[model samples]
Target: MLQGVAVWAQTDPGPQRIARFEAVEGSIQFQSAADNQTRLADPRWPLAAGDRVWAAAGSRGELNAGGAIVRVGDGADITFTALDERNAQIRLTAGTLGVVLRDIPPGDRFEIDTPNLAVVLDRPGRWRLDVDPQRNTTRVTAEQGSGTLYGEGGQPLAFNAPQSREYAFRSLAGSQPLALNSGDAFDRWSNERDRALAQSPSLRYASADIPGVAQLDAYGDWGNDPRYGAIWYPRSVAADWAPYRNGHWEFIPPWGWTWVDDAPWGFAPFHYGRWEQAGNRWGWIPGPPQRRQPYAPALPFGGARPNIPQGVPPGFRPPMQHPMAPQRIGAPIEPLADQVRRDQWERTQRAQQDQHQADMQRQQQMREAQQRFQPSYGQRQLDEQRRQIEQQQQQQMFQQRHQQEQLMRQDQQQQMQRMAEQQARQRQIQQDQMQRQPMQPAMQPQMPQRMQPQAQPQVQPQAAPQAPMMRQGGVQNRGGGEPGGRGSHGGPPPNH
Candidate 1:
């Protein structure tokens, strides 16, 4: 392990914590402490003290310093005045910034200095600071945190959540109460980003103390290893891909020859862990969670040398010899120049052959894994197709049932209508028959018959008296009254 350790000539104590550009939107640039020239910012680029970041108009940038998340709005300029184990200081020159101090280490200090005041974070919470150079004012909004603002020759003004205050740059005699306005697009974007990072799945595997761990959830997956405990493997990498291959090196002062990866999820793994080959895939082992790991400039392996840029600053003195140089036993006979050249050529050939073999092996392993997964993938596709067919069949059956029910209802309605019409037609027929029938004459009541004359035998011989009889059918009847007998006029007699 000692032989593999990289040696560096340090001018100052190494920073236990460093900030990296976690995200960038639109035009953003930075000036490094070692190189004063401004360059386009890369998300993987590590930030140190004396470095300045600028977000041009219509641009934004975000930085992750340990667990603290810092976001700069459009047209903002900020400088990392100090960043180390126990202190993080930022100088805001213009525009707005949103800082979320999720967890401040014990005895650690986080401060933001503006033209008007120096805002020192006192607790872990959300904070927003705005520097208006035109108005010569600094505004502090403690959206969900507490901090103290120190001004020139004035009392330290302490502000807490749900508070906003504005102070003049020249004097801090008093601060005017300002309304908390988080409705702006910048604040909304910052808050949304913070919420997403807070819920990253990578948090469960890696320690939050590691900067850029939040990005791992998007570009990689975490797995449990029996030997390495928790390890992370990057997704969508080529079979021949290896750590520190897709990045360039820049001599960042204090820590020379830093690696800047092109990958988005490249910071924390390269800076804080050891890479191991488990099977054919490379995984990052974040060491033991119990231990505090210092930031490393690069974790190169396989006798890799730093690609130092030209025109290095005079202050940075590279090592006199390669750190990996072997020890010599006494003073051996020096080799001829031709012999040295021949030995160098042989070593280069061996290294190239070794690299080629490793790449071929990795490719073979990937092909095998793909072969093993193909059947399962095909099975999943068949299962999905079956499910879709079943769903379609069920849906068609339901539609058919619905249509049948509707037709049955229509049939029942038609049957009922027919029955009603038939009944109505029968009623009409009965009414017409009743109107066609003939009428009969009313009957008159019969009168009682007169009593028959009591046997008048002797007096009838003297004279035949005329007796009036009822007229029947326009004929008069003259005869002796008899009971229930026919009259002389041939009409039926009435009842006696």
Candidate 2:
């Protein structure tokens, strides 16, 4: 059945069971005003009440309440509001959300809102959406089947096919379909880190393992968790890293730590300044970790005054020939100050330039989007429609030629009659041509005088003996009348 585009709204109000929420795989650690739960959210996590969930990349948290499973890529945040069983709303504040439907009961609806756009899923199928808050753009890919997109004004944008993607500008009212790629999925996953922390606010934490430190005595017990695989410092440590008191630690699964290991953020740079993990234990490899102090003493300047030469006068100096000259202290002061000022100025300029570049890039993207998304009455779509039409025409032409050949073969009686008539006509033409040629002189002229007188004219050859015309019904004689054989019917005689 063809899918149509239409917009509809939820008629109910207040928090209700619009759909069921579950964590099919990975873990969905939730921390809200009323509840705090962190467990293996496999199979499904039913949302008894409104709660915000953080999903790990490549991991999925299904919100059956909206009939959609928002697959959190690398770092993503998704909030669900079950206004009622009849209608619910989902906001993919950041990252990517993959929504698939098992079976959508009638009157049940799912709506997803992003910073750039919103999608209302009233029909079934698999679809993925990516939200970029930095650039304020939303990208959606219809993986299988299709879905409908509801813009700000509540107009439906229909997308179909196995892997089709579309881009929606945040400030605009419509979207432009884009060529889809798998990498878009990963980009959505990677971009969710900051936004996830903002909504749930618990995912962000500080690292306690600084280099050259024996133990986190000041910030006690800072190490990797054997279960969740991320480095975590207790709230009791420094108050600086603590964002919330008594909140669930939702792990932001980084691409480190082997399948069964329990050390989040991997065993790389996130932990100690210089260390490598070998086997089950972490190893320390040191060099530059200890050398970057702010101040150090040069050898000759060590705490002693130099001895003066015996002849030197009390108020005289060694003509400034000393390795550590007195006047050198203030020399080039202006040049040094100038260098520092230049560095500061350059840094400021660079920052301003960078901001300008970013703005230009954004504007260029918006311009390109506007050009591509101009209101179309679906006229440019005719190229694909035309291709389909031409294909059909070619198929029809081939079928017609095939049918004509079949009909000719089926009429065997007419074929035989046509062949016989053609052959008879050919024979008559040949007979006429033969009759047009005069009979060749039977006797050649004999030499006269010198040789015996020409022999008496050879008996005039009787008109070359007429050949019998063989017909199916009767045999008839055909007398030759021309140099070439001719039939008595005034036509060429048959060769036979």
Candidate 3:
């Protein structure tokens, strides 16, 4: 059953979940693969593979793909190129993108490409990619962990922390070093968003691992329900609002026919669990955290399979623009300058979260016994582990380019091994089939000059014909190889 209502990406594979985007400012429109129609992109729309996302001159877009998050700059045209279990690649046709990664599992890759250069990230890092279509150049700034920039001719350039590089659209034109770019309007804005998410009033209400909880802070308020734990009520939705009414249905592999909600705070509530209506209001119930994450939940769609356009899972369709009255849905959310209590808030929830983590881990263990790694512990453990890993990396970080190549080699080797195993199995099957088949007569090679063909048998042996039945005695003569076989129906064996 399609369980998750608003799963972010497609396929059951890890890291393939779509990236949820919330329009922070200006005019951003998304173009789906099936219908070239462009609609004003809304917040909480998950950008899956083959989807093209663009921001108008002054508009900005923020996307969150599970643990990885990015902010798209103005006048930028970016496409979701490829996304799967171990890798994600986005292509920038114009403008800039800011990325911040909290963790990157080994054997996994994150990449961004422009006309002339390709940037690949294998470690936890924060960086920015800028494409100058008019100038035929690209710029990169590494804010945190190191990554590599590869030129068109496959030349590689290293980008250590606090490093910047520029490249012209030339044949193997090497990257030029530039001063670190840390402060700018975009940077400030990005920082502000982090701070907002960090201090969101909803932190106490939802799971910390919930991807887009940060954006919900300024958009909605939490209400206590007698029936469904903590429920978030959006400020703009009408009193009669219900889930799935405004979203379109599209199929994502593994989990088919996912619902893409238009609400900015739609991700967490829709993907995690169920929604219930009480009195004149509707509330989201984020079910208990499970070991496995869903791409989207099973939304009740009146037993109908919504239209699926693309031939693939990581495909997209234009935003379904249902006639919506602005006031009837939601109004602008004004930021509230409430007292920031992140420290105290976390302190109070520490014990609760620890217990929750233990429960989640146990549940995950049951659901995915074959999983090698699980986020069963609290954030502290993960942070400490990441810190130690980073320290070790800093010591050996200069060899990043070589490491990239080595990882690539390892992936290729694994692929080759899989192919060889498949070929071997095929060959074994063919051999087994040949062995089971009946052998045909072998033609005698042209006998030596004087040899002659052997004569064929004149007659073949046959079973002796049975005697006619002696119906008068109610008996019939039957032949048998063994002696003393029953001569007829065996009526006291006519004393012979």
Q: Any idea what lDDT model 3 has?
A: 0.61
lDDT per residue for candidate 1 within 1-496, as digits (tens), equals 1112233345343455678787788898999886687889876667788889989898888888776888999789999999877899999999998898977767989999998889899899988888899999998898887888788875587777988888897566667888898588897788788788769888777776677888888798899877557888899999867665676656666666666677877788877765656667777777665444568775423222323444544665432222322332111111123224555887899999999999999999999998877767688899999999999999999999999999999999999999998678658755753453233235634543333442111111113343433333322333444322243322243322
Off by over 4 Å in 2: 1-28, 33-45, 56-68, 166-168, 171-176, 181-496
How do the residues 1-496 of candidate 3 rate in per-residue lDDT, one tens digit apiece? 1221123333342233566664468888887654555667755445566778888887777887655777898788988887655677889989889888766777878899899788888688888888899999888888899887787678786667887877788544555688777577778888887776678676566643355666677787778776545667677877656666666555543344555666757676656544555456666554433222334433221111233333434454322322322221111111011101433465579978999999999998887865555555686598888999999998687689779999999999999999998678658755853554344356633322222242111111123233232222222232322223233222221111
Give candidate 3's TM-score.
0.49
For model 3, give the 10-residue run with minimal summed lDDT. Answer: 331-340
The global Cα lDDT (0 to 1) of model 1 is 0.71
Residue 174, candidate 2: Cα error in Å is 7.3
lDDT per prediction? 0.71, 0.43, 0.61
Q: What would the TM-score be for candidate 1 when compared with the true structure?
A: 0.57
